[model samples]
Target: MTNYNAVFAATFAAGAGVMGMAQTADAQHAGHNNGMSDFDVYASSEYGFCDAKKIASVWGQSIWEGKMTLANKVRAGLTDLADADIASAEGVRCDWSEAELTYADATQLASYWGNSIEEAKSKVADLMSGMGHKRFVETFADAMADQTEGDEYDVGGNFETYVASSYGYCDAKKIASVWGQSILDGKLTIASKVSAGLTDLADADIASATSVSCDWSEAELSYDDAQRLADFWGNSVEEAKSKVATRMSEIGHKRFVEAFDYVLR
Candidate 1:
């Protein structure tokens, strides 16, 4: 046998290396008058390989001017220029300068916006337009932490809305965690439970029922039992119950929670 798989893999790897070298050569040739080094060309090739067209476009526009470090960072996937700034560079005038963000800021902004460093910076810039650089940095950090710096009611209101929409209390907790709130404490309250559509079940009893197995749909649920079932299914107790209710209702069963009432009987 000719071992076709091994041969194909080797051929693909060689082709990729050749492609990288060719792109580097092209970048060098294009920027010959600008004194681009072999390393710069290699970095540009890597940037292109990463599908960072915007950064590549900006590099080409600047003719490698003041961009060696930024290009290296982009090639390494450590940071990227802002997208809008790159677009501005690609325009006829081509006066867009380098991104003003640090590597950490760029990385965080990229994660927040789920976009290239360039785009994230532009969005962040717009968001922090009126603030000084220090204020912007501090505000960005606070925003990521979900803290409003003592802005009362904003976090709670948002959490309440998230819980009420049947998204589950855990998800609400995650949101609240970002805002530095203890959502568990908030959700444990009677008003919060009712608002989230959760039935009042004793937490201790729910803790005792984890090993018990029965047809959940037909069983009566104490608060404890419901909580255990919710945990088992990776949902909020209210969400688990709501799903059961919806399923039973679909099958023409009215009073859905009552379907589980037989456990008590």
Candidate 2:
């Protein structure tokens, strides 16, 4: 049999048909178990699992980061530099968990093409289909980038405030310089400042500095930034230069420039 039933499965999926037994409407098929239940299988429904669950599974880990994970579901639509970072972290893949299984055709292949050509093609066509052998990679992204651009997250209530207070007064643009999404909590100001100079550094050098010198900080403009502003405010040009020179040597010239900009801003 050509499994014309898979055609039936397709029509059935358009609305409310499911394959194999599952707990929810069609989560098991999607590969994202919302709840911690074996019964909470991937929804196999053509509709729900294909989009929602699949979206959740692959993106679940990637889209999730910083304080957003601490917020309520459907609350934080998506977050800042974390959003872009999640995308950059993504490796090239055939499809998400919700996508149709491939075959020589085996639909479920954790690794490269399996045993036989037929085995390689053994995929779940009803879930997705094509003329014959082909790889289905629709987008090269992992999040709703255009829809949820910038660091101004969509979380409701105190979520934003909580993230800001715990993290700092900075935003996504500040984070992208050194991938500052993981930098929530106490060192917020410092972390954001450390990544400051990296705007002009090469990607590799920036990454290196970020990894090694990540602990630098001005601490809410009260330390280096405040002191510099004060120096330039009521001192002779020589005095100011001397002060700036000292700070630069202490924190490096690039970092000093970054801190000065942030302080003045």
Candidate 3:
């Protein structure tokens, strides 16, 4: 199978298999479910968004108390808690198989396991020792589906975010320039392009950014997009996109630091 098909297969298994497991678990644990397996209960709990909220609240308190920095909390707090929960749930008989994870939880699981779902499942097998591995992988697949359900292959939403975050402002500027050129040549509006989800357009945007040198001065942006970014980043409206891109290029990754960054909170 192609890489994309492999990914699709992994996600499909998680979505379809999770429901089947949930139904089977419910019937099996009908009356005496309370004292059932920890693994099963943990799986079921992931679907309960309220539980995630409670966990977030506790993490907030920890931040307030200076127990951890906001960055640290953002990075590891929830994942750590989830891992702890998984560790505790191991070797215990489960009540239900309805385990569904949040996007963030699934992302962490993927990071821990592997590049692809199959590879990740193998890592889970290492941890699970053949127990609950299939269920965990299925639940993770469910999360993957949730994350990409509507946004798949969309050029504007996740693609834009990915470019900005992964390649920084320099690359973002290049992409915007190339996209603007495409608009001029194809007589396409930004809205139309975004809604179109043309793979060639998306591929071109990525290719232009990755293949070129960073040059904020040469980057193009529509007047509206430039103004919006300018207002958000405290740059003057005159040459707004370039100005914003210049600042981002200069700041680079250090913008995350509390002191060295030029942009205000």
**Candidate number with greatest lDDT:** 1
lDDT of 1 by residue, 39-110 (tens): 343343322111232343445422222233344454445543432333343332210111223333455667
- Candidate 2 structure lDDT: 0.28
- TM-scores for candidates 1 onward, in order: 0.18, 0.17, 0.19
Q: Evaluate model 2: give its TM-score.
A: 0.17
Candidate 1 lDDT at 141 equals 59
Instruction: Report each candidate's C-alpha RMSD, comma-separated, in the order given.
Output: 23.4, 21.2, 20.8
Residue range 79-156, candidate 3, lDDT tens digits: 455444334444433211112122233345666555764444334444333233333444545444444444445322
Q: Which residues of candidate 3, in runs, are more than 4 Å off? A: 1-54, 61-80, 85-157, 161-265
**Minimal lDDT window, size 10, model 3:** 62-71
In candidate 2, where is summed lDDT lowest over 10 consecutive residues?
16-25
